[model samples]
Target: MSGTLGIDFGTSNSAAGISVDGTPQLIPLEGDELTMPTAVFFDFESKKMRVGAEASEALLRGDEGRYMRGLKSLLGTRLIRESRMLLGERLDFIDIIARFLHEVKTRAETATGETFTKALSGRPVRFHSEDDAKDAQALVDLKECYARAGFDDVAFMNEPEAAALANRDVMQSGDLGLIVDIGGGTSDFTLFRQKGAQDIDILGSYGVRIGGTDFDRRLSITRVMPQLGMGSPIRHAFGNDTHLAPNGIFNDLATWAKIPFLYGPDTIRAAKDLHKFAVHETRLARLVKVLEEELGHDLAFAVEAGKIMANTPDVENPVIRVGMLKRKAVLPLPAEMMTKKLSGLANQIGEAAEATLAEAQIAPDAVTHLIFVGGSSLMQVVENALTSRLPSAQVHRGAALTAIIDGLALGTTQAF
Candidate 1:
């Protein structure tokens, strides 16, 4: 029998591995890197599709292509099934995601010289926290994606639960631990008790549809979008009356998944009309330029970079570089301001963690360890929120990007 592949198909990044001699061995999906960014670029000139860092490089080089990130977030939405033309191919989000996953499988096979027939994939506890139907549909959609990616069969484990499994050794027998897996699009929690050296009993798992992307969106809406006339007024077509610009365009522009869809001709025309009727014509002109030039992804990248800079400690004068929009255009993003903007979301995550404990009938102080995994868990704001709620627990940082894949790989032998 061929081995079972373990895949962590994440909203921002992805990884794959397999169990070797009962130990997890991660594949180098991108030339010695265990994880690859979940991004794709459809090149117009070459009529090709590029995945991972190559795709990002294509976008950074200002190539003529459609660059898409956050493909995982579209799984449960209507947009996932909507077809669009890309590089002479009519494809939907599922097809796009399948291609990316297929590339991962090919790379893994090439690296390890092994055939994988079955898969054990890591997924969030809730893909759409507010909608049960969408959440369930997301699983069905992902299973189909795996099948399309060439896996014969697939099994799923909650992301936080996978992290919990991987970090079980961090706690001694009888110790209670909480796993906080904060990724690009979701924050997940898992409560478990370490029963033995290599085992744990899961108490509960919970997740919320908010993460790094949400932070970037909030920051962009508050700081960057205003420059593009997000809240500026527009004059009536035939009267002196004015109204604030509609938020639809600006909101989509700030969002990672929606940026690619906003490049259509209709949106461009609307932006041009807004520019023409704007009380602040200069600002709306920037908006028109962005839509016409297809710079929404670039703006989003800038916001993401600024978010990282602001999150870093002792960073002097953190600012979002919008020189791409206009020469010398920079937006200041102080750490305090970012915390203020994201505090509410962080609090919600904390409350979710508390709710997980409540569901398990456990007390916050009873958790002896707090294991943090995934990229967004590094944010000081999130740490503050979780620590404030469970101050007695000792915090341990798991492999930020690969913990889920590590656990999945370890579980692959038993998953089948």
Candidate 2:
């Protein structure tokens, strides 16, 4: 309890941990739940704000409000500095994220009966893989958020490296390990040499801006967009034949992080124009209905839920309920289709893992253990890709949701 706190401010979910009597334990943040959903809702009628699960519940309960998830994805993007009107006041995104982090700090202090001024926060290896300046800016923004959340000072640890530290005890000295961490916002890989129970040496690390949210978007585009006039036709201005509907709007709708930006007046007017000059006008009408009612997030949630369910072994056909639409409907997602849809993304992650080994000057067969961390690592596609690439190495699974925090907690005890 006297040590620094370890916080994993994740894209899909978040958790905080601390070392208690030499053992790492996750603090209960959401009424006995170890992790809380990263979501927020602003109710206009009540002029109130809700965070985590309560935020999602408020939106699902038919409240008049704006529901936002994937807030972490905004970091390093222009939207992070943008402001929006809420309850007659303009608010910045950074402050909104700080509010969520502050709630985490409050609950952890209450659970441990101790106050924390310093934190060891977990961060991806790269926020923007292709841009160096933006990646560095992401760290600055996160540090500013921690400051606003009432922390005196904070330090960061690479998420995959933290996962490595958490599992170091189980690995023998001289064992080469590979850590594959696929979370909601990014995929990270780390190569390390375990030197003993308490010592480890990192070799190389790589990360890409793709993860569970990206899978949700691809699934939405494959299954949901067709139903909402993606491939449908519109009347041509001069030619006798019709032309396909423009993909710009559908692409935005399929993306979870871009939903809020598509509700402006200009986008609505454009959709209306498409609806007017359309073959199969009903589908475009449904698209218009979604924009008019601000149901993009709702549909995104449904798609994400279905995608997760379909990844399970027992589930054959997962049904995605679209209750927000005028006529309630369900989309049945078959397992094969879901797997096929995500193969491309999974392959990219696999390639990143392979590249990590090469970057460290180690062969694929040299790795003694291939460790899987994070929630999205459980997907069949991801597993298949990893196992296929590292056939000789034994696979290990860390605590899917807590390994990063556990590592951070242990890190706080070290001199570095």
Candidate 3:
């Protein structure tokens, strides 16, 4: 029998959920995962593209040529076609979208043991669009793509509202709280009052197209590049914004990496590592640009040791790691250094909070507590920022980063 599923189509991470017996249970894929990379891998000659997160941050660091990511940013922007070309030649934007949607759908379908032909997916409240217009057309386009991908009907919900739904149970005091969702590529804020049961009255929501991925990239370019010197072409390899970058380069890179026969004897020996090399530690990318800034000779090829220290649980080692000169040069970013890169996004969160307050006719003190959600919200700096902004209230840390998507799935069977 067909069932309903919830999908969180995050810019960098995605998750799926569903309701069971009036309770929402997050369906795990591959490894009890709630969030997987919005990335795809492909072969120059292949039948279908490989999607879903199959590699780790360390894997991405050693290779970058064929890795595809940040497809969530393709909504209503001028970079639509440029964003989809990563799937292969002559592919439409919906083709790439359908490919990803299909993969996420398939995994959830398998885990739930029921085909999910209908879904409730989360979307940012405002998507940056062409000529200063909202990306309303993107939703229509996505609907068409969803239909083609075998979804009978797909409904949309404001991401924050979905997150608010996930937290409806604990809010017992009739308090108005702020839900801050700091995701991989965007942050969304919503104010809600628990109206008893599953219903939530959303006051006003706020969002910004900036998140953890931005921090990682900023650290890579601003801090990591300075050590390599400015005027490096390697810096040019990454697009200004992950979503705004040219898709041609990304597609071409993906095309080169995926070999037709992955299990064949003639497969690229470094097949898996190829993408990591480019995305995380492109030695050739480094060598190609080193000479421009007079660092070609002085600069040496290095592995991105602790490249993902930001994701690591241990305070002793950064989530991201880089080792240079045969372990002679190891540049590990400290917690403060990483936190500094996240300040701008936190500032944006503050602005969004104030804006929400202004619209709701409420003061800063009126916000009882700030409920922080998403993977990035767990950062100490982000936690402190919320604390400073609503010093009089508590910071609710019980909600998961997967709250929005989980609620979307929960909404599929129950009323939102």
Candidate 4:
């Protein structure tokens, strides 16, 4: 059996959706699953590569010298993160990205139990740039990677336009709406003016490189790290590594922003050293994921608690403890800290949405509907900020982080 597929190859998570009876349904990543974390795991010894759900888990335990995740954001680029395993074997960043895509394709095919080919993937209307040139070279790298992964044909469309197509049937005559896709690395907007069921026109598109990952890093560096005073001492001993954003913060990070550190010279430094930072920051994500899912307690929180209380606060061994930052231990940051970070992002999301509207020549009053699309759109901060801007419009369910890809899958099939 042969079926066309639509893909949203996102930075933090990747999703596939299928069209059934003119209705779009998000295809299970490994079957019976709505989405796949766009993570990559590599066994330097076995050279085995894994992606999606299982990969997300294994990669966190990933050896610092090996295993890589979050390459979906690296698509269409030559920039590669280097990871060296215990024995000193190194893996390229682009290779990690290719392997993740391969895993995504393999799992989808395996779940459906079909030999399928040809895909239409969603592309951001605006790509992140190093020096302001449109990232054409990155696109070329991505096409090459997809081809190498065995797809016979690959195509792309504007992410929001594709999302609009997914909800095309919901459009009525004279329907006008806005799309606010707060994705892993960017917050994008599109104005849709529907003339008919199949004749939706993209009135305009605008975007900015801001989203969820920014908040996570905010918590890590500002809230958690400072609480632990994780500097100089840890750097001298542990080699200046040990960076993370929690699963909760990561989900927030998934809301969008190209970089984790949103501002300052430190932010620029992180951008230039993105590869190294990805490794360092992901370790933070790994720590949080492990503490929450594996330990089954807030042991992580205890250390963070001590840091705030007396810098030597103590707790029982079974519970959270302190004095571990020097030894490379975990902590649960203060709630108030995470909240402050969220508020900061909230302000940016609002400003970016307003600025995009001005650029598109559309006023807030002209917006009839404002929809949130992308995995990061699930963030309360993002939703509240975007909604506050469009007081008169409607914001659709963005829970289906996979919807954009699903809609694009349907659109590409129709485009054919």
Worst 10 residues of 3 by lDDT: 252-261
Query: How many clashes show up per model?
Result: 0, 0, 32, 19
Tens digits of per-residue lDDT for model 2 on 1-416?
55478898999999998886767888988898988898888888889878899998987786998888898888877888889998787877788888888888888899888888888999999888879999988888898888998988889999999898888876889988899999999999989998967688999988988899999999989888888889898997677788899899999998877887898999999999989888888788889999998889889989988988898788766877776654678888888888898999999989989988888889999998889999999888998999999998889998898888888887776513
**Worst lDDT 10-window in candidate 1:** 1-10
* Model 1 TM-score relative to the real fold: 0.99
**Top model number, TM-score:** 1
- Model 4 shows how many backbone clashes? 19
Off by over 4 Å in 4: 1-3, 44-47, 59-65, 76-78, 81-91, 129-131, 197-199, 227-339
TM-score of each: 0.99, 0.94, 0.75, 0.70
Residue pairs of candidate 1 with colliding backbone atoms: none
lDDT of 3 by residue, 179-246 (tens): 88877666778888867665678899877766665555555554554443222222233464222222
| Residue 127, model 4: Cα distance from true site in angstroms | 2.5
Candidate 2: segments with Cα more than 4 A from true spot: 1-3, 236-241, 326-328, 414-416
Q: What is the lDDT of residue 329 in candidate 3?
A: 54
Q: What is the C-alpha lDDT profile of model 1 across 1-416, one tens digit per residue? A: 24788999999999999888878889999888999999999999999999999999999999999999999999888999999988777898888998998898888888988888788999999999999999999999999898988888999999998899888788999999999999999999999999889899999999999999999999999999999999999999998999999999999999999999998899999999899999999899999898888899999999999999999999999999999789988999999999999999999999999999999999999989999999999999999999999999999999999999999988898896
Worst 10 residues of 4 by lDDT: 228-237
| Candidate 1 segments exceeding 4 Å error | none
Relative to the unseen true structure, what is the C-alpha lDDT of residue 93 in candidate 3, on a scale of 0 to 100?
56
Ranking of all candidate structures by their lDDT, best first: 1, 2, 3, 4
Error of 4 at 361 (Å): 1.7
